[model samples]
Target: MPEIRPRSTIVVTLLCIAGLAVAGVALAYCVHLGAQRDDDTGQSAAEFTYIPPNQAGLAADDVTPESDEVPEQLDTVRSKIMLCTIDKIGTDVLSVHTPDGRKHQLTLSPDTHVESAKGNEVADLTTGDLVVVRVIESDTATTVDLIVDGRVSSSIPDN
Candidate 1:
């Protein structure tokens, strides 16, 4: 009925374009957040391998103890003893403290298995829980295999 005003048409077009720009930005941010969450999930899928103390040069034959001379294989030893404080316990990974008082983060992958007589203790672990973790150094970082005793209070004391 009434004539369409040129100024009104321009204003409407500008408002529509601004709304679309805002929506685009919001969508991009959501995608970025999703990608970050996926990255964390991938990290938790790392595998673990156990290296015996003898093979790693930490311990010689139990029956026959070698002299104090360090073996040549010690240079290749990729595992270490670490006392850590549980900073965070996630669905997959665990944040721990290194012996030097620095925080060393460790991942709990599907292959990163744990052996504990104490059941469900892993899930109930809280921040500040002290744990002695045996970790094998890898290309990316160290991966935990055995939870050494004397750290977790819930564990039964060794005879």
Candidate 2:
């Protein structure tokens, strides 16, 4: 009986070690697959949001994507195109209200340009300023250009 006990313990320990090795290999393989998804490889699948077809009698061309804003995964902000009133301003952001009173906040990065009508610094812009802001829409204003009095006053990034 003592001999049988020792044999059983050896078998159990060997089985446990083999199982752990298999688990480690599976974990490494899963991480590799996840890395592939982030690459631009053809092996990656197309990412899309699900919606019923022809829900609003609109064609695919006219239909908006599930998300109209720039994806958060992007490090750069996008741009927008519209005329709106500067609703509010803070240290690093500005809120612009549309003609219909819909407000959107524009983000300012360290690279954002703040200029005046004659190529000077627009140090202060007020809440009532009428502006046409061309924007690339992320969660915040990624790329934004402020047009005042029918001229480009400020824009994000020189290019």
Candidate 3:
């Protein structure tokens, strides 16, 4: 018959090797996962996560279920509004200087809103007039609203 020590030693060594092989595979898989980078940010599917501005809850690392609903578009439109003073005015052109001394010559849309302290028209606009200009910009159209002297006078919407 066979010697017991040789058979037992062979079996123990084989088992130990198999166990080590499994452990090595598990460690390699863990390292692979750790080396992965997150490239899903700024994608439309993950954009506009509905986290309100200045609201605190549910950080990006929190696990979330996969949603089938269409993601909302982020507000990349109407990104800024500036209060500017009229530097120059013309029939088809309007120039304004912002408080930071940057000047912009805006093309006058046929439907541009020209408002003032009094019920005034574009011809009534004069140099040094303080105007609140709400600029609307989209992929196709750019328009502006001219509100003079803080009166709720006129607006340029969706044009």
Candidate 4:
């Protein structure tokens, strides 16, 4: 049997304590973030539900566990909804600018749905129209699922 050195034991004890301290700090930070409130809705930020990209058109209550368990497509990532102004239009693509001043070029999927006061087709959309877009992002592509003209919808909040 070999003798245990006092220095080795001290070093091991100090490493264990440091690891515990780091873990505690990380847990406290997560709790703090979860407790933070969203000023606009007067709700906790953590309460926001993560809607899957394929189900962006569905209401929060409409999403079912059965659907969520099986994704429609593979390699698809997260989804997001944005209020954007149409900057430019193409045959199958759109360039839009968000309120935050960022510009994005969006491609419409073959089955993309468009709702507007003017018409339901993509040809009816014009430049400078405010639209609420629900988009699904993937590693290989960014696809638009739904587009609603903000003028006809009360969903767009007033500043």
Instruction: Say which candidate scores most in lDDT.
Output: 4
Local accuracy by lDDT, each model: 0.67, 0.64, 0.70, 0.85
- Rank the models by TM-score, top first: 4, 3, 1, 2
Q: Report the number of backbone clashes for model 1.
A: 0
Alpha-carbon runs more than 4 Å astray in model 2 = 1-78, 139-159
TM-score of each: 0.41, 0.38, 0.42, 0.50
Q: Which is the leading candidate under TM-score? A: 4
* Candidate 4 structure lDDT: 0.85
Error of 2 at 82 (Å): 1.6
Q: What does each candidate score in C-alpha RMSD? A: 19.6, 17.6, 19.1, 14.8
Q: What is the lDDT of candidate 2?
A: 0.64
Error of 1 at 66 (Å): 32
Q: Judge candidate 3 at residue 141 and give its lDDT.
A: 53
Cα deviation of 39, candidate 2, in Å = 32
Which lDDT tens digits does candidate 1 get at residues 35-114? 56344445433443345455465543534346544455554538877777888888767888766779877766666544
TM-score pick, better of 2 and 4: 4
Candidate 2's displacement at residue 92, Å, is 0.6
Candidate 3 regions off by >4 Å? 1-76, 138-142, 150-159
Relative to the true structure, candidate 2 reaches a TM of 0.38
Please tell me which model should have the higher TM-score, number 1 or number 2.
Answer: 1
Tell me the TM-score of model 4: 0.50
Those runs of model 1 whose alpha carbons end farther than 4 Å from true positions after fitting are 1-77, 113-121, 149-159
